[model samples]
Target: LRATHPPPRPSFCWAIHRDLFHYCALNLAYMAPSAREVDMALRLGFGWSLGPFEQWQLSGWSEVAAWIEEDRRAGKTLVDLPLPDWAMDPQRQVVHTPQGSWSAARATLSPRLSPPWLKRQHFPLRLLGEGGSTAASAGRTVAESEAARLWTLDEDILILTLRTKMNILGEVALEALDQALTETEGHYRALVLWSPDPHFSAGGDLKGFIETYTRHGLTGLALAQERFQRVVQRLRCSAVPTVAALQGYALGGGCEVSLHCTRRVAYTETNLGMVEVNVGIFPGAGGLTEVARRAGLRALAAQSPLQVADYLQEDLTRILRCTVSQSAQEARSWGWLESGDVLVPHREELLHVALTQALALAESGYAPALPRLFPVGGVEGRAQMLAGLVNALQGGQISAHDFEIGRILATVACGGELPAGTLVNVDYLLGLERTHFGPLLATQKSRERIQSFLETGKAVRN
Candidate 1:
């Protein structure tokens, strides 16, 4: 998967977009299914990023059709299929819209395809932000910053959508999230964190960090990261009901934000993980803290107090694995998604389901989750975790750098200098994370890892 290699086409692009355009045109030549279903089938069934019609348009339907017609004349037809009417009449309109978060005109089709739980009563899609100029036809916009927007679906539901490239959790987006949460209080009953980008988020904008760190070094990077963490903490404690509508990649900070939300309505196809380790860092933006905390809670709930340490270790190991989930169910197993959270099979209905969940919580009188003193197996636990990690490194299961990261992860999980069976708060854990994380930013190995990722899009094993 290098730039030098031939670029891979979207899945099924060759078979469906090119071959089927000529070979199976007869099936679609006379009668056409709703473009939504066709698009859904391509996306859900084959994992194609774009459907046949969209890909055809990109290649110019008229030109492709003429080529197909020429190929057919050359006896190159796979089947004697008549040319599609839409291909012949390129001006004919198709009920198609780009699959995006703000394409609410096409959102109406979602309800029909959604689950029974998504109560789509009168959810009028209204875009909120300074992008009123373009989104005016779709929905009303509220003037927020350009990178993020507040979308109102109904009187009670407010959707805070990140509009930045890849919906990266940059300064603007985080600030907008804080502002939206603050402004929507008493006015909007609930909030849904969403994005129009294919990825819910790719985590913090690495390009942003690369620039800052390259220019001003670790001091500037630390300040930027601290501000990001503050917003994440705020989201975790926001009084209003909040739901993360997640699909595609929710890595590192993206996954951390979802973990902090009141609920997560995730698409089955979500690729969620705390993937900061790939860049020689751990999940410093509340991910490590929350994963350990939530796993402890689950273990505590099961009346298996002895299993808390084991659960925490499992979570820590998963973070070190940096294993991106293949599906939402896998994400749940990874502790990135909770058991009570909703999983949507269709990506199209993810937002609707999330908004419904948010509204449900709001109607039931939503309250911020109480702060928890996570029961940790302090020094004893850290020793045991370190022993295991050391053994893994000796056994060549992980690299020396991975072992170092794991040691930091274990120390943070153990609540710093606390004794065995001690309970620690979020602030204590965050302090440990920040303290451990800061020095890594200045490490030659860390700098090399980050640079390798920025340049090659892969981790340096050393």
Candidate 2:
């Protein structure tokens, strides 16, 4: 009888894993370079998050070596090179020490010379260790939660690290931030918000929002939004200097958090934006308010009202389209990054630069910025912005929901029914955000867009 069923297919991951093992084995036998060097080459040259040797070590070196041996015996491996003795020995680690990593060629720990690696060694106390210790011993750790931690540096600087997945801003993170700010009042000279994750923060917890809305309805979502806004407001009004060390994607609430900080030190690769509109909501956490504030300041500097009008129009375009800056330079052009903000060329140098700037600010007797009235376009500005959206809607250039979002954004950005060139405080702009946010969130199309994004990670125009 002929077999009708097709044979089981090999996994792509397994094939890649096997190839990686073979490649590392060949390199170790012939090139005789340190595992760290190989890892660094792949990271710097190829932009891999993890090198072959690093991935192997992460997957358990001995276990992977044994599997390779089995494959070699079965004539399945790409190469016949024997696994290194050091790798098979469970006691010997490839990169175990802070000072250096193990080299197969030298059969010794090679000294690590990377600037970031060297800098990290200076700070011996992390609030939470690799083993997940949360003990607040010897003033090293002031506060900690599952989502975030507040730890001290060498010069009375508090480092608040968001530990959530993608460092998403949630209730736990917000609470931790509030506690960190409270602790920083008289104790720490400066505060730095940073993370070791690939992303500084992807944004607010979309999954959390879905769960909340599904189980507890709009009221629950509104309460959560309110809590987030209050915490961010406190960050803006913080007595001490707050520095944001930004890299990777700083979108939505993450961008808002950085926006409120005293100064931002960004990596050249950093991507920043107020992208909540893609998920069918506006930046309710003072993001639009900050943009409006910046636009007002720029307009004040301009010699003509035409320049002021252009600035407002540009910001309006960004808000409605959810423009995300591709690089630090672009972010600066978009006005998300300020002129005074420092841009670090190396990812490793971001925290160092940020810390230095924070210390400098503190030493220079930095004071929190006082709340002041800023110029807004007011009712005429809102109408002017809406006119373009109305055209786009009539011309079928944008969906009805897009027009609706633009309208709400226009209202918030223009300061909600005030006269042209009205001067309003930050709190008033913030209030407008909260007020308009609910209506957009309440819409069925907006909810659909949010749900689609959460499920597939793709924005739905509807």
Candidate 3:
């Protein structure tokens, strides 16, 4: 059906040839993401630069072509990464600003070839061509610099030495992660987790957010969330011995990123927080779920944790789990220093550590597990947790209504059976979370203060 472009101008975009069209099919919804399931479905969907790729991506390509071309003709750009999966590695990312990854489709351009026009505009691509691995990876010379370096150990582990300044949430970072995952096998035994600088990451590109939102409304939010969530999910579940070497400032999504790793070895200078609530949004990108599992309930999550302020203040403030050291030397003293752990003191050492870790993981092994079935904490247990929140809402101990609404929405999202990843899609079950969480969230005001107390950090000013 994709090839017959004859007769009337029943035109199509690039007209994906028979070979490319063969890969077209419905992506199976894996009940469990394992074996063929993880790499299941059409990853080609992600790779093909949206265009008049008539042969491959019939409808999706068509839509993309129209959208991108419209933006370009208006001299406007979305400033979003084309390959969002690469942004997971913050230290080794490059931004090609003022250029869209996919070319304007109307001009009948193929994304495979870098446009001289875009290069003339100083398109910030690495400018590698479509060719052999060695030819594609030819080096670029530069003076001494402060960018974090990455290394690999015969496709086993991948180490990331993040220092300061450069950001990694753009498409370049996403591409790197995607490529690594595509190439590798599994985890490493000696995982190194230490950074040269105190900070891990600064989260997604904020300026990009500012630029895109001004032009696109909810569309910008949707796109950003999709890309952000991709990194969040990958980091949370990559099949390897993951370690975060934290020296400082893993805030917002960065904090969540740290939790996804198996080990979070931090210097005392590491101050982690999911402060998205202060900005009128929750850490909707699996931050809460990851933190809950990693650090227990003390680690605050977005929106959901507003209910447990007292618990966070008293229990989580101190005695948080894992290893925390005032300095790298002391970290070794702690049990955090496993039998063969490597210590990285400077920029070079850290990059070597990252290289070794990432490459080791690539060749580690692969037996991807089935997606975990989220427990309801038993029937009595489920009732108890639900009752406590209900009582808090009724007795005015808590002011927000989102808790109950989310419970109801989440329940509806699963039709009573719980799924791990469903809660993030709160809007799907409009039967509950979407319709109710906001009003419930806004239940308290000056006069309409449904419930208020020093403990309740209510959003209502009136």
Candidate 4:
């Protein structure tokens, strides 16, 4: 007769979500004897995004469950909530499901089911002309020196995995990727960029950036940016359909890399962000440009002809704040992802879905994005953004350096002094980004922040 949980206010959803999760978790822990039943009950009853067991897996079952165990022992319990059986056993903390088993403690996903397409041939590639073999089994070699590798799936799709340290984009890795793309051209039906490494990528190597800037100064940094730009742009406009199988931390340049793909198949647990602001620089490698482009497209889609400045304010706020999407769904909300981008329920299904999507696009005759002009936010947007920055600075909410960064971002986003009616293309935004970014690399605050990050693995805000 009556609805169980009333529709919540906008501000109340977070509290409701948190409270309901805790309630369900506690009830399921003690009452329901079976893990699958508990999972099913919570998912079906409340229409939860993830069941309690899955949420437990994501939140570190062993540690959080251990806390529950200690709390139970101390009699600091809530209602009649029972402790989960698996919580009592350290070994059983890693929950098992038909799709896969994930151990939050180990950060490992061991899939019980493998996709049908993966049953085909597996090939190992040795890039950079280094062909030394050591226990080459099933075409996968254990090469210590190689930075990139390609695997042929179903003899049609070529999956390139960047194998550098932390999967960071080094010069060697970039060079190998470019060569792979060039060689695989017209040969493979589709190319999928993927890695089973803990992170899709942490981003470009900051250590490499520091080394280059220290040694070659601005000239070296400019050259490196050019190479990075060229490779990413090439990927963006590739003839063969491309898909990035993304998971874990895809931040900064890693985020940029995905922006260049024909399509992105993101794992639900992806932690995606454009975090260059943390390093005291704007996104130089087509990331900010991509964001601007997406914002422009959003404005074009609106019915009421919303001011481009309104969209710019919202989008640039995310960039300036280094907003990270904790899940695929959230990434979509942030406009980092397109409506057409695929969201894989299980991380194990990411590559398979990507491969399938790539094949479908290829079969449908994939068309690369056309070179088109976008409407820049222009003079009005720039004035509004600068005024906002000034207000924030006056309020002592941001540092002077941050204000300068915001100004640079505003200039780039609005196409740098372009008139209100002028249409700006991708090249214009990219050029503005590169021009501003190079100067930041030469700044003391940026250098200090980069150095601090390198030395202490923490951002130094000046």
Best by lDDT: 2
Error of 3 at 246 (Å): 2.1
Instruction: Choose 1 or 2, whichever is better by TM-score.
Output: 2
* Model 3: CA > 4 A from native: 1-156, 161-172, 183-195, 236-241, 292-366, 376-462
RMSD of 4: 11.7
List the candidates' TM-scores in order. Answer: 0.81, 0.83, 0.40, 0.71
Q: Pick the candidate with the highest TM-score.
A: 2
Local distance difference test, candidate 2: 0.78
Q: Give the worst 10-residue stretch by lDDT in candidate 3.
A: 314-323
Instruction: Kindly list the per-residue Cα lDDT of model 2 for residues 307-369, writing each as its tens digit.
Output: 334578887787678888889999998878888899987776677788889899999998888
* Model 4 TM-score relative to the real fold: 0.71
Positional deviation of residue 246's Cα in model 1 after best superposition, in angstroms = 0.7
TM-score of model 2 (CA atoms):
0.83
Candidate 3 lands at a TM-score of: 0.40
Report lDDT (Cα) of residue 9, candidate 3: 43
List candidate 4 segments past 4 Å from native. 1-145, 303-306
